[model samples]
Each structure stands twice: as structure tokens, then as C-alpha cells.
Target: SVILFLNKVVISQVICKALLVPINPLFVCSRHIRNRYKRISASKMESATEPGESVAGKSTAMTAGQKKEDRMKRFRELHLKRNEARKLNHQEMVEEDKRLKLPSNWEAKKARMEWELQEGEKKNDCLARGEDYERVKLLEVSAEDAERWERKKKKKNPDPGFSGYAEAQLRQYHRLTKQIRPDMEEYEKQREACGEDFHPTTNSLIHGTHVPSKQGIDRMVEDVSEKQIEKRAKYSRRRAYNDDADIDYINERNAKFNKKAERFYGKYTAEIKQNLERGTAV
Candidate 1:
């Protein structure tokens, strides 16, 4: 019994020595790591996240409200800085306008009046031509002869509803007379008595100069070329009130309209050349 007990004691010591020695591991479980290790890994992940975001705790960075306040502060600073530039540009525009001596809208009123007079003269000329044509037609044959001839022509294929020369005269008068206001007649008579020569093509004042639609106060920064646009994209540190997306959209639309106009004018010119080749009036 003593020898058996001594052998068991020796075996126990050998097992303990084997456990104390280090050896290569056949397998390792990731789950066996300490909670402290897990916490360290989680902290690294949180630090890698964007500002205003946190994995296991509230973000220490500015909130949405604080961001808005910061943006407003920046805007105020920029506006204050650019105030002189705005004033200088406005002064320049005003001085330029004064030097050019731009006319008021009422400056064209007299030209419009002259245009009206020319139109009246044209109308009178048309009426005179019509009257001359009728007179010549009447002189070619007597009224009685015309009536007799018309009756004979109709009688050749007469029906019960053959109204005579008086009916024809009534129809002619109705066709010649158009409605005219009493005021328009008086105006025309006054215009005729003035003996003024009003011709549209002869008078440069008749066509007024075209004014720009916008005051240029809010015009987008000029970008005339694609290369310039790309350069702007790369280096434009100054931000606009509007988004870049809207500017790009407008540029694309303008390009489309320009392309369309070019195509239309190209086709129009081609058609004109073809007409000339074929000896057709264009």
C-alpha cells in the first residue's frame, strides 16, 4: 500500500510539471478572451467612427443645433467682409448708366406715334388701290350691260331663286363696307391733314433698343468653358448660396438650347441652298 501511494504521488508531480511548460496550441477560441479586451476593441471602433457618432456612448462633438449656429456665424462674417465689394460694384454700375445716358420708356412714345401714322397711310393707299380697281372694272362695261349679261348667264341654267342685278349690287356693297369706329375715322382724317411722311424702314427711331432682362445683381459667376468649369470644381474655395447641382443643371440646359438652335439654323440654311439649286423661290 506504501509503494502504490508513492507511485501515485510521482505521477501527480509529472502531470503538474507538464501543465507548467508552454506548448504550441492546436486550436484557440476567440470567445475565450477577457471582457477587458472586448471593451478595448469597442473603443477603437468608436474612435474610427465619424464625428457626432459613437458606438457605446453619446458623441462628445457638436450636435445639429451647434452645427447650425456655427454655419450662421460663418455667414455673418463673410457678409460683413464683402460689404465693401458690393457697394463698389453698385457704384460702378450707376456711374456707367449715367455716362451712357440711357433713355426712359417714354422716349419711344413719339416713335410709336409715327409708326401709327405710317400704318394709317398704308391703309389709305390700300383703300385707294381697291377703289381704282373697282372704277376700272366699272368703266370696262356699263352697269346695265353687266346686269343683262349676268341675267342671261344665269337664265341659261335658271332656278326659282335667281335674284337679279339689284341683289348683286347689294352683295357688292356689303362686301366692300367693313366696320370702322367714328373715332378711328376722325383720327385718320387728322393724320392725313398733317401731311407727315412716316415710313417704318426709313426711321431708325421706330425700332427701340433692347434692354437687358436682368440687372446683373444676382448673376452666377461666369464659367464660359468646360475646362474652366473643371478648374472651378478643383479650386473654387468660395461656396455659393446655391448648390453646385443647380449650377450644373442650368449649364446643361443652356448647352442643350444652343445645340438645338445650331441644328435648326443648319437645316434652314441647307433647305435654302437646295431651293436655290432647284430654281425655287425661298
Candidate 2:
């Protein structure tokens, strides 16, 4: 009986030790992992809170009154900058206007005359060399076609009667005379000043007409050819005068925008000041 009781007690003790040994280490490791995760989370929370606290403190230090004053100061500074920029741009535009003279209508007319003279010379050369008239014919056809197209495109109602024809003739005459009137007047004045003593060269005279010498004619031709070549090169490469006009237009547009901006800035500043005085500024 005593031997059986001792065996039973020892068996029970061995069973309890086998179950607890496996479970004890697993529980201890799980608790240690949980504690490590808690520490990491606590550190992250502290790091995030520190910056937030500092920002809150700073914001609290800056009162509503101080913020309003700062905004007003910034508004004034912005207007001052706008005014300065406008003034500087105006000064620059004034200097540019002084430096670059815009081409007038008279200058454009002169250029047109020079171009026409060159074209006349080309046509004369072609005819003098006895070249085929195909190119000339083509040019004439093209000009006629362009004129026809223009006439067709612009449908102007013509007036019936001699009044319309007379008005058109008068308009054409005025247009032709506009440029030469000043030149003709100047020449008349010069002739009058010279008086009756001035003897104009005539083809039929007692000493005969003084014709240009061969050397003088050649020199004149050379000068004319050089001028034609220069003009051809200038127009063929690019219209530099047109580019100048475009630059002037862009500068003027920019100056106008700057002026508008200055006006807007002034108006905005005035409104803000009025609001502040009434204690209604945001």
C-alpha cells in the first residue's frame, strides 16, 4: 500500500512540471514584446506633441492686435513696392523713347520710292537685254488678279452721276499732290530768290546743252547700283524697321499694364485703410 501511494504522487508531480515548463517561457516572451511596443509608441507621441506645443505657444504669444498691425505694415510695404516698380518702368520707357526715334510716314514713303526705283531698274534691264517677256507678263497678270480680288472682296456702293466721278478724281489728285506740295513750294521760293539772273539749262541754247561726261554718268550709275544692292540686301534679310515698331508697341503695352497695376494697388491700399479705421478689417 505505501509503495503504490508514493508512485502516484511522483507521477502527478512530473505531469505538472512538463506542462508548466513550455507555457512559462512563451508567456514571459510575449509580455516582453508588448512592453517594448509601448515604449516606442510613447516616444513617438512625445516627439509629435513637442512641436505642436511650441507652435501653440508661439501663436498664443502673437495677439489679434499684433497680427492686425503686422498685416497693415505688410500692406503698406506692398503698395510702396508697386509704386517703385511703376516709377522705374516709366523712367526706363522715357529713356527708350528718347533713344529710339520711331519712323514717320514720310520715311516710309521714302523707302517705298527707293523700292520702286530698284524695281524699275530691274524691269529696264530685263527689257534692254532682250529677255523673254514671260516674267513681265506673269507679274502683270498677278497684279491684275490681286486688284480684281480686292475689288471683289470690298463691295463699295458707287454713287450714280458725275458727282461721284468728280469726287473720286479730286481724291486721287489730292493724294498725289500731298507729298510734292511742300517740295514744289520750296523750289518756287528758291527760284524767286535767285531772280531773273538765274539761267536754267536748256536743250537748245546758244552754247548747246551741257551733257553729263561719260565718267560722271558712270559714277552716278555705280552709286545707284550700290544703293539698290544695299536696299535689296536689307529687305530680303528681314524687316528691321517693322521689328523696331513691334518692340515699341510691346513696351508701350507693358507701360500701360504697370500703370494699371499702380492704380489697383493704390485703390486696394485706400480700401484697407478705410476698413482699419472703421475696425472692420479682416
Candidate 3:
């Protein structure tokens, strides 16, 4: 039974070696077999230690600690080169052109130059054919260009997020105006038709004194005004002070006190208040 057990273990070790995997540490035969295996391995190691008998270009003389230290040294030199860099003079760096020369509005300037060149080439052809060199620029901006400009403006004058307690409905209303593309030609025509005495304040269309654009909006507004206008606006629920009122109050009671104070001091400090609001106060 012991011999058969040894046969199985020998087969397993041979299989592990063939598979190039470590022999299982838990695998055990009797003490005698283990001792015999150790002796055979020792003899093999001794044979390998013979000069010119080892694997070519491989040395086994260095201890693990020595090998690890050499590997670390090589790694520091190869990958982590800060130690080598420390020896160089950082003060003697090549003078970099921090301010690269560029003409004012270089982007637009370059575009204009290219456009002019193209126009010069077209001018000769146009004169030969008796045609005028009309404007190459488009009147309407692309959605992407408008979006880019809007984004730039927003960066300078950022809009509040919904979470920031902003007026969501009011913001949405203002945003809707951007999407409304009014007929510029019709607008210009109307302006020309209007007499020289036409002021913006007196312009019926501008002030919405004209009939409502919607079919039945006039009737609905009139009907609503008769019933709901007085009832709904009997007492204003929302604050009715200047929309540009300073927000210095922390609580409801503080806000009421501030509102009362503003009424009395508002006239006296109006200019100062405006300066502060506009960030022009020294």
C-alpha cells in the first residue's frame, strides 16, 4: 500500500513539473519518502552548482537580499530618475518665451486676412463677368455658434442652478425668448413705417397695447380681469419691493425689519445702494 501511495505521489509531482506549477505543499507520503525526495533534490542542486553546469548567463551565487538591492538600484536609475535629475542645475533651464507674440484679436485678424485674400482673387473674376462682390458673411448665426457665445456669456454672468433657489419659471421664460426667432425684416419695415415721433415707450407693439397675438387671449384676459384680478391681487402675497433689493436678512423676522428699514433709509442711500449693487463701490 505504501509503494502504491508513493507511485501516485511520484505521478502527481511529475504531472506538476510537466504543468510548470509548484507541487502542492499539503501533498505528503510517509516521512521516509519525503526524506528520500529531499536527498535527491539536494544531489541535483549540488550538481547544478558545478562550474559551467548552471544555466547560461544566470548566476545563483547572489543571496535574495543582494539581488533585491541590485534590482531596486536598477529600478531607481531606469524608472524613478529623480536621483539623477537632482544632480542637474534647475536654475540653468533654457529661457522659454512665456509671452508668445500675437496680434490683437489674432483669431479674427487671421480670418479677415484669409477672407480678404479670397475676395482679391474673386474681384478679378467678378469684374470680368460684371458682378458685384457681395458680402460673404452670413446674417444668421449657426445654433452651435450661438450656443458657444451663450456659454461664454454664462461663464462671465453665471445663471443659478435649480437647486440654488432660483426662480425656475422666470428663468424658463427668459430662456424661451432666445428660441423665439422674430422676422427682422418685418420689424425693420414696421420701424420705418412708424413716424419720426415714435418712441419706444409709445410704440403700441412694444408695449403690447396692440391686440393680443393669440386668437382669444383678449377676451380671456378681459373675462379673467373682471373676476380674478381683484380677488387674486387684493393683497400681494410675494414681496413687492424693488426686484434688485439687497438680500441681507437671515430669517423672516429679520427680513420684515430690513424691509421696514429700507423704506425709511432707501431714498437717502439710493445712490450708494446702486453703486454697491453694480460692484462699483470703492
Candidate 4:
């Protein structure tokens, strides 16, 4: 009866809103109508509430208690729910187990095993074929292909990436080498042109068939030896510039000799004065 009433009310609202105008719009207070509908909805919602039951039929029970009767009841409910869930989970896991397990039929199982065994071999063969293809492709590069690649590369970078300074440096090096080549070649030619007769002696002087005359050689040798001896003698005679002992000894000896000579002169002069006075008196 209540459901029939609700259905009729919904239908009337939907149909009458567009077709029938309200005799007295003030009689239908929108706020009062909404409040009435809200109260009805709340009552329905409260009456519909049940323990451990949701709109989706899932249980949300709180079975915690100390009484033996409540505990047993809770255990029974929990065991029932667990059994139901286990049944459904077992059904799901059965498919997964089938996926994991070998087939039961011997021939089909043997075929699957063989396929699994040869899977690695087939992959290896494919890999080997791919490697062979790569090797063949690498070996198949012809001179024309190389030349084409070279042309592409040459076209890509025909210009050297050197700045003016770098180019000038390279040009300078080339010019220097060009200038040095003649000198090096001339040196080599001179070295080659000279025979044993123009070779240097042990003294690093050019002493060969074209050397100075024997007389000149002997005079030069004698002069050099004499100069070396004189240099040694001068070095041996040389004393440190700050040597003071010899200077001090010579100064003391000169002082003593000067004092002795002055005394002898003074004594003789005294004797001459006395003798001259004596002769005058006579």
C-alpha cells in the first residue's frame, strides 16, 4: 500500500507539473514540501537499516562479546562466511592451478613438455639467424657503398673547421719546414761530400789532410801548452784577496826597522853636534 502510494505520488508529480496548473500556488509551499519529503526519506532510511547487511549484501558485523552464547554465535557466523569465501576463492585458484600444473593426458602433456624444451632451442636458432644476417650485411658492404658513404661524409664536412689563426699557424709551420728542408739537405750534402780527409781530429779541430802546416800546428801546440802552464802557476801564486796576516807581519817589520834606523841617526847627530861645538871652542 505504501509503495503504491509512493508510485502514484511520483507519477502525479511528473505528469501534473507540465500539464496542470496549480489552483493556488501559495498552498504548495516549496520549503514545507521539501521538509515533509526529507522526513519521509529519513524514516525510510532508518527502517531499512539491518545489522551486518549493506546495500551490496556484504556483511559488516562486529561480533565481539564475552558471553559464551554470543561467542558461539559469532564463531558460527564467522565459520559460515569463511567457508563461503573459501569456496569462491578455491574456484578462482582452480583456474590458476590449472595454468600452473602439467596437463593430465599423457600425449598432450608430452607434447607440451616437448614444446617447452624446444622453446629455448628455437630462440637460440632465431638469435643465430639474426646474428648471421647481421654478419652478412656487414660483409656485404661494397666499394660503391663505401664510396657513396665517403661522398656523403665529404659533402657533410668539405670545409676544415680551422679558424684564421689555426690556418695561419699551419701555414707558418709548413713554410718553416719548407725553409728548413734546404738547410737540412745542404747539411746532409756537405756531410756526404766530405771524405775522411776532411774529418775532425780528437781535439774537435778540423785536422785532416787539409789541416794547417806542421810548423803552424807545432807552434800552436807549444803556445797552448805554455799558456796552460802559465795559467796554473798564476793560479797557484794567487792568494785570497782578504789575506791579512802577511800584510800585518810586513807592516810590523817595517815599523821596527824604521824605529831602529831613526835611533841610530839620532845618536850620530848628537855626537856630531858635540864634536862641532868642541872644535869651535878650540
Which segments of candidate 3 are over 4 A away from where they belong?
A: 1-103, 125-132, 135-282
Note the residue pairs that clash in candidate 1. Answer: none
Tens digits of per-residue lDDT, candidate 3, 1-282, equal 578777877988898899998986365555557877899999998887875655432455446668899999998777657745654535234222322356558779889999989878877777787766553222345779978988888789653233222466677568656765776776676667665634655544545544434634765586467745676468455444666856789997787777666756879888998899899999
By lDDT, the better pick of 1 and 3 is 3
lDDT of 4 by residue, 1-282 (tens): 457555656665676677885433334345456777999999988778853256435421322233666879899999999999999999999977876785558568788899977766756775877765445555768989989998899889433322346665786577546743244655566567665434666755443534344765786587568865687478634223544532323574674564455445867666765777689633
Model 2 ranges with Cα > 4 A deviation = 1-57, 62-282
lDDT by residue (215-274, candidate 1, tens digit) is: 222232332255446874796353234344323235746745644554458677777756
User: Could you tell me every candidate's TM-score relative to the true structure?
Assistant: 0.16, 0.19, 0.20, 0.15
RMSD of each: 38.4, 27.0, 27.2, 40.6
Give the best candidate by TM-score: 3
Which is superior by TM-score, 3 or 4? 3
Task: Give, for candidate 3, the lowest lDDT window spanning 10 residues.
Answer: 91-100
Pick out the ten consecutive residues of candidate 1 with the lowest summed lDDT. 23-32
Tens-place lDDT per residue, model 2, 1-282, is 346545655655577687763334455456556877899899999998999999988887777769899999999999999999999999999978965776557568889999989878877888999975567646667767978878977756532223345676786577546734244665676567556534645542434434445865886587568865786478634212333332313575674564455445867677886798799999
Model 1 global lDDT (CA atoms, 0 to 1):
0.59
Task: Count clashes in each candidate, considering only residues at least 3 apart in sequence or on different chains.
Answer: 0, 0, 0, 0
Clashing pairs in 4: none
After superposing candidate 4, which stretches have Cα over 4 Å from the reference? 1-140, 152-157, 160-162, 171-188, 194-282
Question: Per-model C-alpha lDDT, please?
Answer: 0.59, 0.66, 0.67, 0.62
